[model samples]
Target: MMSISPHQVISAFDEVPTVGHCLVACITITSVLYGLYQWLLPNPVPGIAFNLEATKSLFGDAPGMIKEVSVTGEFRVWCAKQVKKMDSPICQVFIRPFSKPWILLADFRESKDVLMRRKEFDKSSFLSDGMECMGSFHGIYPTGDKFKWNRQLIQDLMTTSFLNNHVGPAVYSKGLDVMKLFEMKMNLAKGRPFSVKKDFEYASLDVMIEFAFGKNWVHTATGPQVELLSKLGASEVKFDALDQPVSFPIAPIMDFLESVYEAPEIVEKTINAIMPKLQTWWWSKQSWYKKIFDEKERIMKEQVAIAVNNYRSGHVKTGIEHMLMREGARAEKEGREPDFGSEVFRDEMFGDIVGGHHTTSGAMMWLAKYLTDWPQIQSKLRLVLYETLSTAKEENRLFTFEEIRRAKLPYLDAVIEEMLRINAVTVTREALCDTTILGCPIKKGTQIFFVSNGPGFLSPSIPTDDSKRSETSRAAKLNDKWDETHDLTLFDPERWLVRKNNGEGLLEDDVDFDGAAGPQLAFGLGPRACWGRRLAHMETKTLIAMLVWNFRLLETPPALSSHAGFEGIARVPQQCYLRLSKI
Candidate 1:
């Protein structure tokens, strides 16, 4: 009514906005700011950023074959060199582009600390994923209450008695078979240059199959199991990027021929394949096939059915059966439904075969290599074996567990310890929570790593006249005077032996045999340690003793240096080329 001018109208429009319009604008601004804050402050610490440009800068122009990949994305270095130079254990930080915060422990003490606390931390996502893929047949990848209960059940199965009575026999019989194969092959070649790894694999597979299935597939020299085992072992070492997040793709391929036609996929695949007919016989009696649909549950049912039938019929006498019958009976008496799943028994058997066979075989191959490389040590070992075997009866001819226990062969013990120290079998456990480790603040979900040695391995801090010299100076001197003059690089078992005759040595010096006894992180520590440790030790020692007792192993000359060798993972010998002759 007051005849508003155009200038006045424009001023009013600019001064104020509708309440709805203002609210919408404010909401948009808040969202953008919140998104920026999230981008800046992520919860889980982001792992090492993958910089393709940085990677290329470090290793792109490097010459020759790239031997190993470094944790820092650097390449073109040998594994040994990486082990010496890299700060992280196993030469890998395990920090993928999106992986959570990880602290890799290269120092042995730090590794011990982490391993000692198994209850607080669990297996990393990667290992769990791997077990899930490979162990779907037996429900190995359980979670929550099921996982806890199942793990307890499996632990009971791995008792000392079961290993000594059941698993030990299987290992011993297989070891003898391996010795026979070695003798046969050496005879055929007339002590020619041959890869020992292949033979070891055959032996290991034969043993594992027999233990799992209750029969030896390789007894008939021309069996599919032999070939399949070889293929499986070979494939096991190669890392498949595709299987990183999930392991399903590789499971079916383990039995490709059988799986190709989809011929009634029954019985747990992977470790339980060898005992398929036995498992199927048990499964036929179960009515739960119509009720259970979950893959793991179904497979667990089959394994449990086998275990239950065996227990009831008294067919299976040892291993998981013995443990289950004892524990299950106790639980039932206490008015508690054991709640012990079939998966528990299955995992115990599966874990024994998977964990035992390969590791023992690998160790034997490495020991053989060490003996061949250092003939003096081999001579000493043979002398000891001869001495031990000479005084034994026919019944005691084989190196039994009791004999190894009573035998105070320091040199042999030292050699085995040294080999294990130098080449650890596996890097186990990872952090699942944010925690401080060795004063270092590790974030949640970090891949905590452990190794066999620390700064002591590379830099001698032990107070000796040699310690006065700086590591750089010692390294330079080593380079200048590096020859076959008892170089540490040269495998020397005598370094472990105490030379009492050397009058130059002081009597009360603190000799640090740091890793000799105590707890070995190799088989793990505390309750979660390897269940088949004794069986593995017996198998490895027996095989090695048999070989050293019956045959002389010598390294091939340079003319035949180029030969197929063993490939390793974690801490395994890649290959061993040696000439074997009957003693």
Candidate 2:
């Protein structure tokens, strides 16, 4: 409006170009930032950076067999003579090619910190993936609000009360079933070279399936269900090795093979076809046939249906049933939709069976091998078990939880602990968040791993430096060599047992056998700790007690060489040929 000079007009035109250039620059910066974000935040993969190479280097390379490597930087320790050479409780190692870094923590104190802080860390994606892979039948994978809801339901079910009331009986009955299988095998073998491992696997599978699904899948005679169960078990064992890190695109291929060989497209197609029928049977409001059909549903509808039926019938007699009923009721009360139907429930039940059964069996195998190799310790265990069972009806009779508790077998406990420490059955966990561990800054999405095969023997008898009379005496007496591999070879149960100077009696000092304050890292630490620890402990203890109580285990003539075998996802004990005989 005001009279503009020629300079003012030119200035206005110049401002227009300036504004356009500023906008272009802003757009360019934003584009670059977006690209950078994409590069930094890649999609999650199960066991993404697990250090397979390190595991091979440490455990001796079993090419094609070892799948995933733990991200724990433990290779140095593995090669070293001791378990605590690293300054921190956990040590970090970065692998090449993928830049996969792992934290290897064997220090008990640091492990405790990680184990106790559940909210800060969670079960790694690797664990979740395995669970999901097994839980697919029930849609347990693809965790959502529903999966959360279902997990809540399951938590209630796995409580001690439920375990005592229902699951205990089922487990006991299943134990009997397993015993029968062992007996049958014993009879058939008649001192022949029979594979007890294979027999134990089948028996455990049968027991778990029966308990979860309310039906038996294993048979002396082969059929579809039997064949499928066998295939699934074998496949699970194979997948355990492959559950490691590598550049190879093997997951899809493994999945495809597992699908084709084990359960197959036909199995899924059959399941899909039967799903509608199963739903009809499950949802029928007015049918008395619900009970009859529910029992039958174990085969068709899977374990969830069996559990639901048990719940509806007011039979909270098993762990699975208890979990299902509690979950269902809680969901109703909270006005949340039920996440687990019959199919999902079945998947979870089967998951427990598959996940738990072999581990216990494997422990038993090791117990047999160790006890056989160390007869003196076996005698000690037998004496303790016999004395504990003195008031019981018979030696071979199924032992109760109380009896197991009272036995207080230190050597037996130590042997089991040693096996768990030396021969790990599970893989290391992945870190979920950017967290500082033992004063080291761990970025978010780091894969944390651990190994049990170390030379550190967690013993209560070992004298602490503080307890010695003089600093020199402490240093001389408590030599660093005690922490070395040679000392670890002294896997004597008495190392856990405190003794008097007289060597004639036991010390009155309380033994913290659980390693609550000691250097042990078997079950892992933090919020994502093993959910089934109690069950696992009980199973291991029971199997050990039973085997040691009756049978005398002998190490094979050649000392039965055992290696940790890999089948992609699982790290398991390689087949050990052992010698066994009736006590």
Indicate which candidate wins on lDDT: 1
lDDT measured at residue 304 in model 1 versus the true structure, 0 to 100: 59
lDDT of 1 by residue, 75-120 (tens): 2123223335543333333223323433444444445545653344
Q: Tell me each candidate's TM-score.
A: 0.62, 0.62
Residues 120-149, candidate 2: write the lDDT tens digits. Answer: 555554334333334433222323465565
Model 1 clash tally?
Answer: 2
Best by the TM-score measure: 1
Alpha-carbon RMSD of each model: 12.2, 13.0
Per model, how many backbone clashes are there?
A: 2, 29
Q: What is the lDDT of candidate 2?
A: 0.47
Q: After superposition, how far is residue 551 of candidate 1 from its true place, in Å?
A: 0.5
